[model samples]
Target chain A: MALPTYAGPLERTWYYAFRTICGLIFFFLIAPLVVIVPLSFNAVPFFTFTQEMLTLDPAGYSLKWYQDFFGNLNWHGAVKNSFIIAVFATLISTTLGTIGALGLSRAEMPMKTTVMAILISPMIVPLIISAAGMYFFYSKIGLAATHIGVIIAHAALGIPFVVITVTATLVGFDQSLIRAAYNLGASPTYTFFKIIVPLILPGVISGGLFAFITSFDEVVVVLFVGSYEQRTIPWQMFSGIREQISPTILAVATLLIAVSIMLLASLELIRRRGERLRGITPS
Target chain B: MAAATTSDGALTTADGIPLKASLARAERRNRNRALLLVTPLFAFILVFFLMPIFDMLTRSVDNTVVGSVLVRSVPVLSQWDDSSGELPSEAVFKAMVLDIQDGRETRTIGKVGTRMNYEKSGMTSLFRKSGRRAKQIKEAPYKEALIKLDKKWGDINTWRLLKRESDAQTLTHYLASIDMRFNDSGEVVRQPEEKQIYINLFIRTLKLSALITVLCLVLGYPISYLLATLPVRTSNLLMILVLLPFWTSLLVRTTAWIALLQKQGVINDFLVGVGLIGDDGRLAMIHNAIGTVVAMVHILLPFMVLPLYSVMKTIPPSYVRAARSMGATPWTAFWRVYVPNTVSGIGAGGILVFIIAIGYYITPALVGGVSGTLISNFIAQHISVTLNWGLAAALGSVLLALVLALYILYDKIVGIDNMKMG
Candidate 1:
């Protein structure tokens, strides 16, 4: 139900109290992020407000931190590593997860619920257990501390997100379309590529985006399975803070935040388009 | 015409007109295609997911030293008063002592001690000493030597811990992690009153999780409500704002808090500038519970808001108006009506926040000083610093058990299937 915005005197007071409290909290939630965007371009390096210093003071407006972030080999390496791992992991997880979703959606497989639960368990199970286990198992096969090791580990973690998003999209899918394609003598592979893939492209893309983000942002698992050569941005950021808190990290954070916002916006667009493709308008 | 049709039907029985075999082959091909489609995923899971969990569970019961040592002393230790939890026969104790000592001399004690220390402290030294010079227990001067090693040896509790260890299988590591000890008489009992630990840490973790969950809900609920009600454009913008932090890495966010919350950091600077307290008054933000709560809440609020918003969006406004028109005051209407309807959302959000908070490691380690560290921190220490996988696994098992228990309870109370927060 639409919440009551106004009421009798006591009710009105309660309403205002709730709204005021909510507004304050909303500000608190967004404040840290908001602070970073401006601080990224701050004339002064310190996080503070100053009076009447809008124009580029010779020292204040320097983009040296940003320059260092892009120019430093360490930072550049981390960024490249993160993107490579994220892209590869996302592709593997989205492809497998979508195929799994299609199979489960159409068939009345035995123990279907259990299979689904098992697929999603990675999301629920604590990372430490998984990380420790992976460490031991991977070490035996000489996969530990390798880039391929980190990618497989991340893809495992990313698989659940892909499954969840793609499953949701597949829920309302029509079976009759598949039957029609079969009736027209189209091969199943041809039908999937020409019909099902385009129909569920939104779900697939959204799922892929989440998988990419999940792998990009993951640190705890990477921390265990990876060593120096495979360090991603978050892992680097972690050590950066531990060793020294430089403004260069701030520059990195601001850049990462910008990239994340752009990715999320694109995801939202994909969601909107998928909804439209499915003939469901945004409410 | 009828006679001709009958003759034609009789002639059409076999190969020329039928495509049944082709249809059957096509179905077989479809089945094979499905199998081909799913095999890659199955291979990935087998290699990556299932194998790891199998390895982890194996470590849970991995009793390598005790297993190898079983044949050497099981028969000799047989004569001891196991029920009294009394110290075993001198020979058996001697064998154990020698084993422990030899284990120590060969540095096997360190490896075996990893499992025993998980049960209780000082076990490695006791076992190593007994193994090396255990035969001396038969000598007349045994009491003095025993007492010299540990004054508690004179008491039955100490002997009880030893007697408990004689078993072929060991729960000592698992039980001791939770602060329960075996009585010498061989019954499991609460760790003697003085040594009970980890319980408090577990409690503290729970309380911390509850506190963080509450803080997130208190802060996130109204914003979620507002976001749900705002014009679509505005709500979408606000939602993006909520999700902005999520795009960045968690390590980055926790580090950001470190930058913001340090003693000479912006928070302290702001407090000093505002005259809230003296310039000398350093606000205890990071390196303590306050810092942990603040940083955690900031990171976890999105979990709360997204669920709350999804639930809030579907709720039509007409219910509130209907309540208002039917002789109910607005305040009464909201308190009785709106809030209860939002319970599912709150429940979904609370569960998500609590589950995530319990598994928190990085934020607590980075921001939480000794006093602020949670149980997961100790589990990490057991693995990383101490290289004690047995204890680490036991502690992890405990944490895993608790999380699973809470999950089961939550599911029973409000079916997990009924809750969704994306």
Candidate 2:
């Protein structure tokens, strides 16, 4: 990355300019996220920083927006629904995804490419199309507006993440180990729980995390498939932004960011552990 | 068919089981287990995901509502040809009167009017007024009486529109979605100027997506280059900045943009304090196309950076160093030797970002004010408020088709199996 010793003044200027541009671009990536945390604590019901905030006065900040978020029943209901739906969706998607990936990982599996494409189509297809489709179909089956419907729809969307991550993990699995377990007189089920599960636990956990986050963050399908009783946090935030611009949403956004940070950190740790398990090292 | 057999003249496995029957059963059992494992989720997705979309697309052309609502009159009206531009006979008008009365009695006649309004404006009030008046008249000269009630009933064009939209399935909704519709004489034609919004919105969406792709490349190239060229320790530390937003909640990121870019927002406040702009001159940044672009670029930047960074990291730096050592100037070596190598990354990043940006709804709906709503918003509008699911379905199909085509191209360029997450 160092410049040549014989560089002219023009070259030196351009080099510094290029680095400055990159610095600004990096700042652009992080500044919005950083700016909102402080703004969410504003004492006034405004998005901008007040003069006192700039002067570092303690009076300029308050937790009233967070208080508002907690006190409001609509927000409370949405948060509750978000967790309930996400948990069940994660459960279904992870269970189905693990088994599906196991089948897909088999070298003997027929039409592997076609099946992979079919399983992952939910991810590739646009959410609007998927939402529109589910909206009509769920209503037809009398599942529209039900908690189970939204969960099922979200699970469908989450399945691909599980399949992709779990399949990636399964790629490094040694099939000979399974054969050895069976040859040693262990039951097929026992071999799976004892041998396969231990090796793929990290992938399964990470895949479950992906499924959970996907369900939690989803809004489009919920908008179509969910009724008033099934409103999720993202759904509420969507109507909030649409109907009213308020600081309560900013507060919730900050809290959601905290949750994401936790999820991302866990994923990073899982990736490292998975790599170690697979005997992979950075080049 | 012949099977491999042991010297004992019996089909058998190496372990001495019958090879022909045993091998076939084992293979069948293996396939059954695989199919069993996939069946639950596959059935779930087939029922919940694919079925609804297929049903929705089918809804785009489903004209059953209008046909059924005006069943008695539609067949009668269809007999009147456009050759003479003549109003239908009194029997036709009487049938229309009976159908309108029956529709109002059943409380389903409003649907027919709504369907016709989607085809021709002002048909809503026309149906409403006639339905109310149709209940009052019992005269034999029903055509004149109906015309006297409202002159629009006498117009052949209204009857033509009614007959055109009376089919059990029609392409009217699909045509309307693309800013085209059938004229009164049954010819395809452009919609009126005021209603010609969707075609422009589609064009604008493509243009903005392209612009965002360009913006992503411009801003992301330098950042990816820095990350790729810097020491591993520094690059790894810097990589977190890119991944944080990548994993962050989309609504949170959009809200962050709103907080930063709205009128009286942080950026405006800061600029006002710094005397860069007057207090009244606060930039309208958040509720316009610019807001959509700025926030979308921020949200989608990581997508561009990850692919570009991955590709750049794989390219050996020695190639450029060798080019320079061989008397290629730094500029020449960088462009001719270095830039071409990142083409794969650019293609991957560009296509991924463009496809996502085209289908984006939340950010655009929130920050993109009236003038900024993309085609996806319009589809959502028809789905929800307008209650025109047919048009919504048609628009959705177009979008779905467009995305699938682009995805196929992307798969061709960069194998889907090679897609990775950081």
Candidate 3:
């Protein structure tokens, strides 16, 4: 808001001070994330900037850490496991969550509030508690230390996001479209595929992205439930931090930062698309 | 036709069904379809998610180790009174010797020892040493031989401990979780001064979580106000700054903090280069309480901001403008009009941040040194390092109770349906 011409000196001073505080807060949010990008390329294995780096000398930077990350067999295995588990978990959670969200958004659904709470409890409960419980129970059932176990656990964790996003999209949906399609002689399956799926595709895809990220970044549950054979990227990074302080981790963090940026951009796109489909213009 | 007729002039459908029954049938079909769609997920969560947590709750009080392993002695010891100030009869000693011998052969007596050790120290070694000598004792007056082998066997407290732990269900783990234990007379009391830790850790966790919540509000409020008041295009652009961290990998953000906060890291190097302190005086920020508070405030600030922004965006500016026009001071206008409207936002963000912060694990473990560590770290340690699953489960139950309570509060203040993710 622009200052009014009749504003007093005190108002003017407070306005500038407020903006300054917000600027610093914004810097606090973004600086740590941006600071690591430059450090990841440091020529030395250290975490700080060197004298040459301050002067913008090309000699002070190197891609050796990236090379190290790419060449390590353990990192490769971790990457493979991360994608495999995340992909499967995302698929399972997306399907189950989409169906559940449909029911949750229906006006006729029974015990809707309690059911929603139970469905979302995974997101609400502490991760450590979930991990400990899963470790004991999974061990008893002969599922501990197995890839399938980790996958199922991650899938369970991812369901809430899918349920949330998809149900949000369904909230704005027009139910009459389904009835109209049925009146036009389309079968229930055909109507769902044509009318419902197409309309909610954006929500489903964004929800799937959420589920994917949830699985990919998860470490605690995998630490408890999986063996070394199922080590994911975050698990590897956890041990890497604890066992050895290495610059390669910085490189990996940089890569993950890139993934986050891409995901954020895609989520924005999906949000805008869904809004447009629902005929809501940006203010 | 008469059976289908209603005395109160109820309407009938085309098929001679009453109109209310026909409407009810349609509604039931819709409800069944909705329930059908949801059943698979509900059942899946029940089996995979809820059951495991319930299993852990059961494990917290699952005390069958001593009962099963020391089968021969539990019954005999249950009859002997510890307050009598006398040793058990020879039959009791005979039962103990046989039990120890059988446990040693089965290689399961160590579990009993570990469980007992939680109640009283030195019981593990007592059990192991006694087991080794029990098989060799082949004489009458087994009590004398057992006492000669180990003076601990003759101690009256040893029998008391055995009697207490032999029950199928016990509250000892739960007691120890809160730093309370059964005294000599079986009354629950605080642990010895040096041994009291879990209660303090719980307090620290709550205190730190509250501090972090307050910090997030202090930092988040101004920015959220700025975003809410700015032009839509500019605010959307600035919103990226908040969402980037929200979307970033938790470990990645934590790693960045390590790079920034370590003694020799970026912040220190900058300070040293500017002559703020001697090179040897670089601060130890990482692995401490300061590090945890700083990093977590940065991480959780977004949770505070988003809710506040959404709420603030809905508040009409006319009320504040009207207050200013009515001769109110700017501070009064903002506080009396604007701030009151934002209290719901504060409550939602506060409880959300506190709930998440209390259960935080990775950030504290990575950055929080011994003094900075939260209760979650201890729970993890018990699970992985100490292999004390029961204690971990007890601690987790306590933590879960806390979070559930807060979560219910959050739902009351800000409905879960209103929880939006960026």
lDDT of each: 0.74, 0.88, 0.93
Candidate 2 lDDT tens digits, A1-283: 7787988899899999999999899899999889989999999989889988899899999999999999999999999999999999999999999998898887667888878877888988878888888988888889999999999999999998888888888887899999899989999899999999999988899889988999999999999999879999999999988887789988999999899889888988888887787788842
- Candidate 2 chain A, poorest ten consecutive residues by summed lDDT: A274-283
TM-score of chain A of 3: 0.98
Candidate 2 lDDT over B1-422, as tens digits, reads 24557888998766677876887888888888887777787887787778887898899999998778888887877777755778888888888888888998998888888888888779889888878878888867888888999999988888888777778898988898899988888899999899898789889999999999999999999999999999987988889899889888899999999888988888998899899999999999977999999999999999899999999999999999899889998899999999999999999999999999999888999999976778889888898999988999998888888888998898888877667766
lDDT by residue (tens digit), candidate 1, A1-283: 1345554567567667877887677677667766665555655556444332334355555577798888899988898899999999998899998997776564544455666667776777678777877887898889999999999999989887777777778777898999899989999789989989998888888878888888998888888899878889988888887787677777788887778778877977887887787678964
Go through the candidates in order and give the clash count of each: 20, 2, 1
Q: How would you order the candidates by TM-score, starting with the best?
A: 3, 2, 1
lDDT of 1 by residue, B1-422 (tens): 01222334542214443345545666777666655655677678778987886776666656666535543455565555655645555555445455655565566655554455556677666555555554455544545665555555566555545445555556766776888866645678998777776788889999999999998888888788788877887788778768877666677677678767887666787788789978888787889998899999999989888888888888887787789789886668879888888887888789888988988888998899877888888878876788777667777787877777767666665554344323
Candidate 3 CAPRI level: high
Task: Show the colliding residue pairs in model 2.
Answer: B11-B19, B12-B19
DockQ of each: 0.42, 0.70, 0.83
lDDT of 1 at B377: 86
Model 1 chain B — which ten-residue stretch has the worst lDDT? B1-10
TM-score of 1: 0.84
* Docking quality band of candidate 2, CAPRI definitions: medium
Chain A TM-score per candidate? Answer: 0.92, 0.95, 0.98
- For model 3 the local lDDT of residue B56 reads 96
Q: Give the C-alpha miss distance for residue B302 in model 2, angstroms.
A: 1.0
